[model samples]
Target: MKLTIFDCDGVLVNSEEIYLAAELEFLESIGAGFERKAYMQSFMGLSPGMWEAKLQTCVEAKTGAPLPRDFYAQIDRISTVRLEADLAEIPFARQGINKIAILRCVASSTPSTRLRWKLQHVGLIDLFDPHIFSGDLVANGKPAPDLFLHAATAMNALPHECVVVEDSVNGVIAGKAAGMRVIGFTAGNHCSADHGESLLRSGADIIVENYDDLAAAIERFARPH
Candidate 1:
């Protein structure tokens, strides 16, 4: 069966900037130098562990303090508040989701619990069947094929028959590595023209800036090849 795998954060919900802003604020509150652009570019599609490792280095260089185990906990708390307040519905996302003729699911780098809460908050929990797949479920996250492959396996769909909708370079890389076609979503400011081009370089078959365009892309995919 053909399947559509969606990335959660920036695609269905407009929470990427909220999360990033929370991270930046948390780091600055703890006296770590936080550069928004640098942080986004470096950690956009990385797993929590990888993010913590990078944050540790930044903390060491800026505050000269060794990374604290509770750092992520604090960041999580801060992000939770910000997300609850700012999580936005992507325009036409629910409409596009409702129009899908194939099975669909979310595959994200965000933890499953958090992803579920966000999806529920935005009224999209029912759009997916059998729940969502998080990077935490696999040994390797985005930029590796594990997460996407896992999702495809869960749906019993072959990689080539599954199309990934993603917003980050790492996600596109993971989708391609998993032998799936990828569509880059550029609704968020984090993904620019250059970023879209990079996603194409990383193996995205198409790029779109809004759900209407995304829906059209999906329809095109449904057509006989």
Candidate 2:
């Protein structure tokens, strides 16, 4: 049997932009300003703890002060409001996923509570709920093989029997490191012009621009080589 692993933020929902905007706003407010591109390259797809640590490091370097104690709460407030007002699934996600027959689960950097909340909010929880895996479940996040390995093991799938669909370079690296074939997803609003190239360099087996092509990509990967 084959298993498909999906990254939640950009692959299933267009929520990456919401989180990034809130983070940038909070950072600038605290004088911990960051360039958009640099921030994306450095921190996207990281587990919450790692992301926060990196932001604190940036804040210290820029302002000689640590991030405020309420930094996460504030960002959470901002993002929660935005998410309630306007959370959208990636285009074609619902239709594509409903039609696909592969066994699948979510493996995301988002914490368990927030991950379930976001998926439920977008009406996708039923699709992958009991199978969802969060970054906090493992020792390391993206760019490390731990999370994907954990997910695969829990789902009874060998690494080689999995196909990971991810939108970030770090996620792709982790998938490949776990010995799974990966499909780089670039249909999210947050994807940059060269995002596909970045994923390729990081070892993605294929790049899919929309969920429509994702099923085909997985099928192609599943064919005997």
Best candidate (score: TM-score): 2
For model 1, residues 1-225, the per-residue Cα lDDT tens digits are 399999998898988878877777777777876666566666777777777777788789888778677878888888888888888777788987887788898999988888888899988888884659998999988888999999999989999899999888788888889998889888775555576776777788998888767767877887886
User: Using Cα atoms with residue i matched to residue i, what is each candidate's TM-score against the true structure?
Assistant: 0.88, 0.94
Which pairs clash (backbone N, Cα, C closer than 3 Å) in model 1?
Answer: none
Off by over 4 Å in 1: 29-35, 61-65, 189-193, 222-225
State the C-alpha lDDT per candidate.
0.82, 0.88
Writing each residue's lDDT as its tens digit, candidate 2 over 1-225 gives: 389999999899989988888888888887787898778878889888888787778788999887788878988899989988889889888888886678999999998998999899888989997999999899898889899999999999999999999988889989999999999899999998888888898899888888777787888887887
- Looking at model 2, residue 67 earns an lDDT score of 74
Evaluate model 1: give its TM-score: 0.88
**lDDT assessment of candidate 1:** 0.82
